[model samples]
Target: MMEAVKRFVGPKWRQYLAASLASYGSLCTGMSMGWTSPIFPQLRGPNSPLAEEPTLQQESWIGSLLVLGGLAGPIITVPLSRYIGRRWLVMGSNLPLLLGWLLAGVASDLPTLYVARLMWGCATGMQFATVPLYIGEIAEDHNRGALSSLFLLFINVGFLLAYAIGPFTSYWGLTACGGILSLFYVPFTWFIPETPFFLVYKDRNTEASDVLKKLRGTSKEAVQAELEGLQALVAREFKEEPKISDLWATRGNVKALGICVFLAMLLQLSGIDVLLFYMEELLVKVGTKISASDGTIIMGAVQVVTSCITPLVVDRLGRKLLMWTTSLGLTIFLGLIGVYALLDSYYNYDMGSWAFLPLLCLIIYMILFTLGVGPVPWILVAEMFPVKTKCLASGIASFMCWLAGFIWTRFFRDVAASYGIYTAFWVLAVCCGVGFVFSATLLPETKGKTFDEIQDMLNNRSKEPKPVAV
Candidate 1:
């Protein structure tokens, strides 16, 4: 059995294990995001535990607070990862998540619930900022996309778990499950090795070499050659640690930062966050005859299945192709949903028989979304920057993502109420259209490229640079 396990992990057991552990953190993030969907409906019901059921305004606060809390994660985790190492920092992130889940399980007041979600948001930020950096450093170039895309796949799994289980359990029971899920990440983290990049950065070359040997399952001679190449690449590429200002100062840095930030914003603007947060509410508002819980479950299932397809083909099809496809698909579906909402709202159209259309559109949107926008941003963020600038740049990009989520989610209900839900969908559709143009014009292909090669490609150095010998 041990031999079987070892054979399965192959030459890259360390990388695979590290990614698996970090992905569990993403799973917790998904659970936190998906929690609102099932719990919101329950809180509004007559049998609610609260003395007074939350008003719609309060509900928005409840949903948006997670993003608001998320804003702190990049600020804290990015720098902290520098000092403590990525492995421990990620392991430590689970503490806040577990506490948040436990608090949610027993909370009797709105304030308590708010605090719990805020902590979960902090964990979300940590995962987003740290995992990509870790995964980028550890994986082999050939399978990097397949490994990194696991981040989104696991997130969707967490979402599906919440949607499938939350409705059947008490609030306490659901949260207990989340807290239990957080615990699983700890044991996994123990066996996973730190990235050789970080070890080398810290002047621990021997340790870095050993880690490389373990990760590659290679002989010492091969590991030494691979390590030397990495050392040479790092020496040539970076002279000093990157600062926040560096994100804009250098031409290459600026281009990379801009792409990361824009992609992050586009992900939120695609309406996935809002959909996950208020899937039930949106279904009710759309007057869909499909039960909200059932619709939410189906959406979660579709997201998981579609997300699985990306890891299989991302390396084969290339990043640019998927981004273009997702952008076009999102634009069409979001626009269709807007038109449906417009007709329903203004034309006094009864959508009873055609009720399934909105749900179908959203499911299709989720499918397209998982294929690219959902996973590619993190992959690109990890790929584009020099190692020196990776953590800070990724943090900035992540912060922008959470900031966009905060703004969109906080006011989504108010916007829908004041301007009509159709207007909100229209705005998202416009964002998707812009995304299509951006993907076509600015996005670079990173398929099957080494980290240094990607940086060179981004800088317009060469399209066919000789492969870095390993």
Candidate 2:
């Protein structure tokens, strides 16, 4: 299987390695989020300065503030990359994340804690915007989908590690151990190269060609052809500086941007964030006595195990098949979880048999959700846009994703409180149904096409005929 994946991936393997490191960074961020959440309760115990209260207001504040910071961070990465290059910008963004983690480790007040989370949020948003961009830029038409799926795999790994550690926070003395672990990323930024597209755009063709040769390890003739193809594409698509408003001005871009934004909103409407952050609480709501923090570790373990399969299957199954199938599966699993919660709330019969059911359903949901929408949108948003508007378009799309995330976190507590868990699951089920319709009609297959081919496909412009292999 490893050899087969390598064979199918062709010459652009090194680029994928770099993209995977960025994916590692993304995974670390998610792990950090959940890892920190369960420990907040510990921090509030009698020994610590804070007091533990599972209040909706406080949870909402933490979730929404991080999202708000995510909303604001990625908008600037486009121009900054254009000016300095992808490598430096990615490196520079880590400062805030590291600093925030350090601050949170020592934080004694609610305001200080919020500030640390805000910075971490900003780091996460920047990763969402830029990692896909970096991967998409360096990938060949045949392997882009596979390369992009790496994001999903590593992040799930992070989620799994985060959950696994939540149960051990007391053993480690404080959650500060996790935050300090996050700070180790500060040195990795120096090791990766600037993306090939950034090199070419700055008129450093020789350098770009050199990087291409090293990354591809193909014959000089093949390397030259690939470099020329990239140069021509970049020169043709991005000859002019992209304006932010361009995402809305033209019909093609508007359709493109609309699809991306709606998809982002749709991805969140699945309630993945709420499920992830509060998985323990939701499990308890269905009648488990295990501590929410310990439950979080179990949730993460399930996510990691399930997510391990996505990268293996994503490229082979094709995007649409994987997406709709997983969406449907998630809807069913969520429905089961909600039903279990409702039953536990209204009835007091034997709860042990049903006890494991909620946990089982949550695990199934994580698996299905990872299989489909979790990683594909980030890859699609990065690939679908023309180089001219790639940054601005992806930025707006990511911003919409974070915005929807904020909405979900803000209302999740109240919805669970008032209507019960069933209502929230029912609402998300309907949203997933709508996403099925939109994806069937609007989301194009981006698996085998080059960026130009995709743009032409989207624009109803024909690709010039290729010579027969003979």
Q: How well does candidate 2 match the true structure in TM-score terms?
A: 0.87
Find the number of clashing residue pairs for candidate 2: 2
> Clashes in each model (backbone N, CA, C under 3 Å)?
0, 2
Candidate of highest TM-score: 1
**Tens digit of per-residue lDDT, candidate 1, span 134-160:** 787788877676677778888899998
Off by over 4 Å in 2: 1-13, 51-54, 171-174, 218-222, 288-295, 441-470
The reply for model 1, stretches above 4 Å from the true place, is: 1-11, 444-470
Candidate 1, run of 10 with poorest lDDT: 233-242
Cα distance off (Å), candidate 2, residue 74? 1.5
Clashing pairs in 2: 44-50, 163-297
